[model samples]
Target chain A: MKIIRSVAEMQKETLMHKENKRSIGFAPTMGYFHKGHLQLIEEAKKENDIVAVSIFVNPLQFGENEDFGRYPRDEKRDIQLAESYGVDLLFIPTVEEMYPTKPQLNMVMVDRVDVLCGKSRPGHFDGVVTVLAKLFHIVQPNRAYFGLKDAQQIAVVDVLIQQYNFPIELIRVPTAREDNGLAMSSRNVYLTEQERAEAPAIIHALQEAKSLMENEERHPAVIVEKVRALLQQHTSAKIDYVELLSYPELKTIEQINQQVIVAVAVQFEKARLIDNIIYHP
Target chain B: MKIIRSVAEMQKETLMHKENKRSIGFAPTMGYFHKGHLQLIEEAKKENDIVAVSIFVNPLQFGENEDFGRYPRDEKRDIQLAESYGVDLLFIPTVEEMYPTKPQLNMVMVDRVDVLCGKSRPGHFDGVVTVLAKLFHIVQPNRAYFGLKDAQQIAVVDVLIQQYNFPIELIRVPTAREDNGLAMSSRNVYLTEQERAEAPAIIHALQEAKSLMENEERHPAVIVEKVRALLQQHTSAKIDYVELLSYPELKTIEQINQQVIVAVAVQFEKARLIDNIIYHP
Candidate 1:
């Protein structure tokens, strides 16, 4: 696999692929590869002639108080993991390389960002969209793969693609999870042994909410309260929020008649974990 | 020349061009074509295998009380003029087509928009960047052309291109002018005959400032004051602003020892006109 560090070199490689009429499938990620990122790369490899993976722990996406400085990065392991998944190109750009100049304009999120993690992490999606915009332009991929672990991110990308008319197709892979049903995340590494043990409770709460919805319980408020109670009772996790929102649009729904996402965020002793289940009712 | 009205069709056409390894040059404009737009098209045609021009009078760029409703549009004339300039594709998408959903997120301009026309017309550059982002994605131009008349716009576009890492090269075409030196603008149609006659004074003021700089005038404030005095005395135009700024960066430079732009804006009885002269010292 070819590894590129500069934007110009990466763009040139993509342009050559375009000229050669080869389809490129891109999976953009922050390093410290987990099962989730590998799955995305594997899916991209299956669909395109070239599967390119970018490992950029975007600083713009992190809040001032967030764990940007301590965000897990393992470039050697990440490169090996990506290569194992048959990634054709590995783009490992430094922060300085990615942002040569301080960004003057922002790709501000106007909608689909008021609920869920967005409420707690303001300007996070904006940073995601901004970096993705830059990467999409550089990669010029035929299709870009994003994991459904970040369903709100997928929704934001949908708006960006529609709003800006970016030519690339967005392919959403299902969320990768641990055997215990906890969604795999880079932040999972931050969890202590005790926090890791409690992390699955977040997913358990989401599953319980899904089961309630499956049992024809229609009231959103009731479902949310039950999930919140379950998290509060079973785990030492402090509930950040347990929200029932319209899928993708993230608008409030009085009754769960259509597709909905039951998302929960909980603060453990050492880490915050998030999990959600999308349901059709 | 192929005329496309739908975003899907335009994107497909551009994709075909990419697959065929053809370079595309794009000129994005608001309809009523003037010499300036034609000059942009002409420059675009010279640079690439395909020259595409998009006519979109973006509503996002206009203020609530601005002339969005009365913005000049002449599709038939524009089409003919573009065809005459050897434009390969003419993309004329309706406002509804361009913005299928009301944009909830905005490409907010943080820098390069606080002075001159940007101060008077807030959110104007944001709108321009938003629509251009859409157009640039849809058209996928190798090189995009813009007139130097709106120097601030070029500065903003520069930031957008640099920040977003768009693959397209930005070509700044020299400002097209009338016989008497008035920078050609579609808004000139709004000017009365007398207003039209006096519009040349805006350019004259810029030239006067340039000459003063050329004659070893070092103070930005002094050059600005002289230009403002000239516009106030010689023309009936109401002086909007006559300021000097560092080129491209548009920052305030106390001393004229480097590349600078002397820009001016004036309000006539029925229209507002803007012009600038870039000087290297």
Candidate 2:
């Protein structure tokens, strides 16, 4: 992997690749390399002539109380993993470089928010789209890889691509998870021994919700209540929210005849864990 | 010039040109085939392998009370003018085709919008940026052309291209003017014989301000007052706004040591005319 830091250099490299007709696949991350990160890189390498990975811990996405500072970092190990997965370009822009001044263009998310993680973290997805817009222009990838772990991000990004007419495809990869169904995340390291024991139940609750939907349970409220009850029974953590909303649209459905997501957020002692299952009925 | 209305076809055509290393110069306008529009196309042709012009009277940029419905368009003549200027592609997306549904991505301008036309027409620059974001993605130009008559648009667009890191260069073409010194615009067709006679004085006011600045006059308010007095004495139009501010930043200057702009908007009997002069000290 070739380490790159400046935005201008990255854009020049990508533009040269574009002129040569090489398909570049981009995998964007916040860098504490894990299985989920590697999976995205692996998928990008499989489908493109060049694989580009960006690892900037975007400060814009975090709220005042959220973990912007000390989110996570492992540059040495991240470089090793990226090189192992054959990443052609590794972008590591510092905060000063990425945002030399306050950006004049302000972006906001108008849809597919007001639910999931977005409900609690206002302006989170706005920050997300803002950064992604800059990155999309910088990298100019043929296709971009995103894991379905944060299902809402994928849906919002779909709108960004379609509405903005970005000449890039969004490849949705299934969420990389541990053997116990715990979604792989950098924040997973923050869980204490007791909280870690309870973390598996978040995914378990979502699985049950999906099973109930599969077996003809159609009432969204009923499913939500049941998932809340299951999580309450299994985990000592506080239940943040349990929702059954239509996929991508994230709207409350009276009849679950379309694709829906059963998502949950749990507040552990040290971290907030989120999990979801997209059900096709 | 080939006329394309479909977004998909335009993207495919532009993408093919992009891959083949053909430099695309985009000239976007709300068409009525004026000399100003032709001048932009002519300049675009000079700089790139392919010249693409889009005639979209973007509804997003117009206020509820603005002239969106009454916006002048002449497709036959506009097409002929583009072809006459050696344009390669002409994209004419209908309002419905451009906006198939409400866009999920929302953009807001946080800087350089509180003065000039942006202040009078709230949400105008936001919508301008939104449509341009879509058009920029679809056209993927090597350079985009804009007339300096709407100098604020050029300034805001400067922020857009810079902050978004768009790979396209912004070519600022000097304002095309009539023989009588009136800035050329399709909206000039709305002017009556008397209003048309009065329009040239707007440009005369800006020229006077430039001369004042050239003669070591530095107070922004002094230049603004002189321009306003000149316009009042020369024409019967209602002066919408008359101000002088720092260039691009659009911020008030205590002293004119930097490049500055003297802008004026006059509401004629039937049309609102805007013009500006960017003066370098």
Model-by-model DockQ, in order:
0.86, 0.87
Residue-level lDDT of model 2, residues B80-186, one tens digit each, is 87788788899999989888888778899999999989999999999999999999999999999999998999999999999888998999999999999999988
The residue-by-residue lDDT of candidate 1 on A129-192, one tens digit each, is 9999999989989899998878889999999887898988999999999999889998888788
lDDT of 1 at B263: 90
Worst 10 residues of 2 chain A by lDDT: A96-105
- lDDT for predicted candidate 2 compared with the true structure: 0.91
Model 2 agreement with the true structure over A21-44: per-residue lDDT tens digits: 999999989999999988998899
lDDT of 1 by residue, B1-281 (tens): 99999999999999899789899999988879988988888788777999999988889899998889998888898888888888899999998999888776789999988998899999999999999999999999999999999899999999999999999899999999999998989899899988887778788888888888889999999989988988888789888888898888888987988899999998887788889999998
Output the number of the lDDT-best candidate. 2
- Which stretches in model 2 have alpha-carbon errors above 4 Å? none
Per-prediction TM-score to the true structure, in the order listed? 0.98, 0.99
